[model samples]
Target: MSNLPTPAEIIAKANAELNQAYRALGDARDWLLSDWDVQPTAEQAATIRRMREAIGTAKDAINEGRP
Candidate 1:
């Protein structure tokens, strides 16, 4: 048998990795907003917003037609 993953397995792995990344992004956003004590500069805030939007788009793509 070939040891390669099937398409379902590949999609599952991608979904799992994206979830981990989303969690990490949340942690970083929280730290920047609260734990760091110092306020994020305007540029930093904009970057965070962009990251959030990008992650949201990724989620939509991965979950496009699942039950």
Candidate 2:
């Protein structure tokens, strides 16, 4: 009990983690595009954009009720 986080604290931590993961994914994608010379086709670009958007949306959904 002493070591347990409150519900709000747990939600805050989870949201922070999710945001970090999303940023990491975006950074990886940027590195591939800029440093690794990625050349995605139109469809591939769309797919990547959608995936990024989905990651953000999921994070928002998860953090909806927390402070």
Give per-residue lDDT, candidate 1, residue 31: 51
Q: Estimate each model's TM-score.
A: 0.55, 0.50
What C-alpha lDDT, on a 0 to 100 scale, does residue 11 get in candidate 1? 77
Model 1: ten consecutive residues of lowest lDDT: 58-67
**Which pairs clash (backbone N, Cα, C closer than 3 Å) in model 1?**
none
Model 1 alpha-carbon miss at residue 67, Å: 10
Candidate 1 lDDT over 1-44, as tens digits, reads 99999999987888787677767766765654565566679998
Relative to the true structure, how large is the alpha-carbon lDDT of every model?
0.70, 0.70
User: For model 2, how does the per-residue alpha-carbon lDDT over 3-63 read when each residue is reduced to its tens digit?
Assistant: 8899889888987886777677667656545643667889978987787777667656655
Which 10 consecutive residues of model 2 have the lowest summed lDDT? 28-37
